[model samples]
Target: LFGYVLILVLVTFDYKELAPLGYILYGIVILLLIYTGLFVHTIAGTQRWINLGFFHLQPSEPAKLAVVIVLASYYSNHDTEDGYRLRDIIRPAILTAVPFVLIMMQPDLGTALMLGILFVSMTLFVKLRWSTISILGTVAMGGAFIGWKFLLKDYQRRRIETFLNPEGDPMNHGYQIMQSKIAVGSGQVFGKGFLEGTQGHLHFLPERHTDFAFSVWAEEWGFVGSVFFLGCYFFLLLWGINIAMTARDKFGVLLAFGLVMLIFWQAVINLFMIMGFLPVVGIPLPLFSYGGSSLLTTLISIGILMNIRMRRYQIKT
Candidate 1:
C-alpha cells in the first residue's frame, strides 16, 4: 500500500511526464538509471542510486517488485503439471533479463546479483525440473561469462579484480571493506556505545547511514545489538514465510515467497557484506538504512504481504 502510494507520488511528481504514456515507464526508469550511473551517483565508480534534492531513490528497488509481480502473475496462471517447459523458463528468462541488464548497465553488480538470486529461487519454487533448471543454469552461466568478457564496463571488472585481492588495494578499492572490518572488530561484544564509534565519527566508514548502517549499529550497540537486529530480521523472515505458506492461492503464495526472498536474501547479504564476510556489492540494510526509496519500497512490499494476509480468510460469496 505504502509502496504503491510512493510509486504514485513518484509517478505523479518525478515521472509525471512519462506516467501518462505508461508504456514508457520502463524506458524512463532504465534511462534514469543509466544517467545516474554515468553521472549522478558514481561513487566508487558504480552507478546505483540517484540523488534527488529531497531523496535518494534507487530505481532498482522498484525494479525488483516489478520483476516479482510479472513472475508471480505468470506462474499463478500457467499450468506446470509436466514440469517447466522450455517456454515457461523462457518467459521468466526474458522477464528477469530486462531488469538484470538495466541494473548491470548501472554497474550495480550487487543488486543485479540479487535479481539473479531472485530468479533462481522463484523458478525453483515454481517446481521447474532439475534437468530444465540445469540446462537453463548452464546457459545463464555462459551468458554471464560472455557479459563479463564483453559487456562489463572497466570499473566493474576492477571491482571483481579488487574483490579477488583486497589486500592489493587496501587504500583504494578495498578501503571500505577493510575499514568496515575494523569497525566491527572494534565493537568488542558490547560495542563502543552509541555515537561514540571512532570509525563512524571520524568518517572512516563510507555511507555509514546507508549501505554501512549495520556497521554503525554494530559499533554503537556491539555484538549484543547485532544479535538483536538479526533476531528482528529472523522474526520478519519467519513471519513472511508463514504468510507464504498460508496464502489462499498460488498467486498469493508466489507473491509472498518472492517478497520473502527479496527481503531475506538482501538482509543476509547486506549484513554479511558489512561484517567483511562478503564483498561490498553495495546492498542496503533495509528499514534501518537511511534511504527513502528503500524504506518506501520495503514498507510497500509489507503492505502487499498484508493485503494478501488480510484477504486470506475472506472468500468471495
Candidate 2:
C-alpha cells in the first residue's frame, strides 16, 4: 500500500518517471517470478532471476512467505515426540534451503543472510534444544566461513574488507560509504533542507534513490526527520509484536514474530551499513527505497501482517 502510493507520488510530481521503461520492467519481473519456481535447475550463479531486458525480479522475496507458511502449517499439524525431533528440524531446514540456495545464486548475500536469520529465529521459536542449536550454529558459521573463502566472488569479499577499512579505498569500493557518512554527518542536529543536499544532488552518494535513500533523508531532514522516520518503524514493529502476542495459535505467533524480525533486522542492518557503523551489505531501507520489486515485496509483507491481524481476532468456532 505504502509502496504503491509512494511510487504514484513520485510519478505525480515528476520526481522519478518509470513509464518509459515500465513495460520492460514489468515484463522482466514477471519472467523472473516464473523462472524461479519452474526452472530452478537451469538457474546458474544466482538463485534470483532471469533478467529479461527490462527489470529484474526476485522470486526469493515471495519465497520467504512461502517458507513461513509451509513451516507454520507443518508445525500446526505435527506433534513432537521429545521437544522437536531431528525430522522436525530437517523439514523446515530443507524448506529454507531451497530458497536460500536460489537467492545465494543471485549473489545477493544480503537477502540470503536475512533468510538465514529468519530461519534461525523461527527454529528457535519452535523450541529446539540447546545442544541442537549449538551444533547448528557451529555448522552454519563454518559453512559461512567456507562460503566466504571459496564461494563468494572477489567483489563481495572486497565489500567486507572495505567496510573494515573504507578510508583505504576512497575512490573505489569505499566511495559510497564515505559519501554516505559525509551526507549523514553534514545533517548534524537539524539538516541542510529538503532537496538541498549537496551530496545527493551532486550524485556523490551512489544509489541515492535506492539503497542509500536514508542518506538523502538524513542530508535533508537531519536528525529530527530521521528520528521521525524511525519512530514510524518503531510503531510498526511494536504493533506487529503485539499482534503476535495476542495470536490464538502458536503458528500465527511464530509467523508474525518471524516476519517482524525480518523487517526490523533488515532496517537495523541497512541503517547501520549506510551510517558506516557496519559493512555495506546492500540492504535497502524498507518503504523508503526506490526499487519497485523491493517496494512491492515489503508492501505485500505488510498486507500479510494485516491479514493475520484481522483474522486473528475471529474465533474459528
Best by TM-score: 1
Candidate 2 Cα misplacement greater than 4 A, ranges: 1-56, 79-82
Tens-digit lDDT string for candidate 1 (1-317): 45567544442332112213333444566667667666774666566777777777888887777777667777877857889977777877887888788788767777788888898899889877778978987998898899889877776677667766777999888888888888888897999897999999999998998999988888888899889999999999999998899877787788889988999998989988876677777788878887777888687677777666766675643
lDDT tens digits by residue: candidate 2, 1-317: 55556434432332012223333443443456457646744454445554556765566665555555556655655656456755568877876776676566667778777878888887777766677877798989998898898767788899999999999999999999999999998998889998999999999999999889999999999999899999999999999898788866666676677778778888999999999888876677888887756667777566556656766766755
Cα deviation of 216 in candidate 2 (Å)? 1.0
RMSD of 2: 8.1
Cα shift from native, residue 229, model 1 (Å): 0.5
On the 0 to 100 scale, the lDDT of residue 109 in model 2 is 79
C-alpha local distance difference test of each model: 0.78, 0.74
Candidate no. 2 TM-score: 0.83
Instruction: Report the alpha-carbon TM-score of model 1 versus the true structure.
Output: 0.85
Q: What's the lDDT for candidate 1?
A: 0.78
